[model samples]
Target chain A: EAGVTQFPSHSVIEKGQTVTLRCDPISGHDNLYWYRRVMGKEIKFLLHFVKESKQDESGMPNNRFLAERTGGTYSTLKVQPAELEDSGVYFCASSQVGLFRPTYGYTFGSGTRLTVV
Target chain B: QQQVKQSPQSLIVQKGGISIINCAYENTAFDYFPWYQQFPGKGPALLIAIRPDVSEKKEGRFTISFNKSAKQFSLHIMDSQPGDSATYFCAASIGGKLIFGQGTELSVKP
Candidate 1:
């Protein structure tokens, strides 16, 4: 099976511009998650989607960011008026949903490096 | 906010030696702990994981030691090789959401 896929390995935008990052999770994975890592910080959770519905969006930093997962397949994170602080690597991961299953099944994408200047 | 704390921001070890990275967390509700390895230009890959019920779990050359009371865990790489050089992250999970620690960059010289 193919691993999770993310496009535009790198992106650079002005501080007030908008940028959208896309992620294609592994086939049949219903749990999609978004995480971001600042230059010297740990990776932080951004949100989670269970199929087309968002299971959790508490990790979202602010109102400038929006995430959507349509039809439970692909996910997109849009940062409107990207800020200089938003420069970091945005990661996407997918996993199967089950109460008894371990999280080792979680597969991550290479990530999109977003740089706001 | 919950957080996982990892020590030794970076480390360098000679070949055929043992490399260890430690992490501690304040959240006792976290039931799952996993270690991830990430190379440059690549995403993090699951190296190994352990639950609270077990004190330790080992796979191949990777070992995860968990201390329930201490709320701490560590990853030990036995017979460390150059290929083991990468960024290691320790993460704790609750309800399937992960809280990660500051990564440790390990450099194994051959």
Candidate 2:
């Protein structure tokens, strides 16, 4: 089976511009998550979608960032008026129905490297 | 608050030696603990994982020692090799939401 896939592996945008990153999860996976790692920092969770419904969005940094998973298949994270701090690698991961079951580990996409200049 | 805390921002180990990385978590509700390995410019891949119910789990040369009471866990790499060098991240999850620790960059010298 194909693993999670991300679009536009690298993106460069000017400050105050907008950017959207996309992720396609593995087939039959019900849970999708968004995470990003800033320069010299650990990866941080942004939000999670269980199908078409968002399970938790507490990790979203600010109002400028938005994530959606319509139809619970693919997910998109949009950054409006992107700031320099938004420049980083955005990763998307997916897991099967079970919650952290050993049989299925979260499969992550290669990630999108975003640069805000 | 950072739920998970990992130590040794970086480590250099000689080949065939033992490499140990430690992590502590504040949330007792976290039942699933997983370790992820990431190479430069690549997304993290699942290395090994252990549940709070088990004290230790071993897979080949990689072992995870989980301490539920102390809320601490660790990853041990035996007979370390250059191929094992990467950034390792420890994460905990409850209800499917994961909280990750600061990653540990490991370098194995040949």
Give the chain A TM-score for each candidate.
Answer: 0.96, 0.97
Chain B TM-scores, listed for every candidate in order, come to: 0.98, 0.97
Interface RMSD score of candidate 2 = 1.3
Model 1 C-alpha lDDT per residue in residues B1-110, reported as the tens digit of each score = 49999988999999999999999999888989999999998999999999999999999999999999988999999999999999999999988898999999999999
Estimate candidate 1's alpha-carbon lDDT, on a 0 to 1 scale.
0.93
lDDT of candidate 2 over A1-117, digit per residue (tens)? 999999889999999999999999999999999999997787889998889898899889999999989888999999999999999999999999765685775889999999999
- DockQ of each candidate relative to the true complex: 0.77, 0.74
lDDT by candidate, in order shown: 0.93, 0.91
**Clashing residue pairs, backbone N/CA/C < 3 A, model 2:** none
Deviation in angstroms for A4 in model 2? 0.5
Give me the runs in candidate 2 sitting further than 4 Å from their true place: none
Interface RMSD of each: 1.4, 1.3
- Once fitted onto the true fold, the runs of candidate 1 whose alpha carbons sit more than 4 angstroms away are none
lDDT for each residue of candidate 1 in A1-117, tens digit (9 for 90 to 100) = 999999779999999999999999999999999999999799999999989999999999999999999889999999998999999999999999775246438989999999999
lDDT of 1 at A107: 89
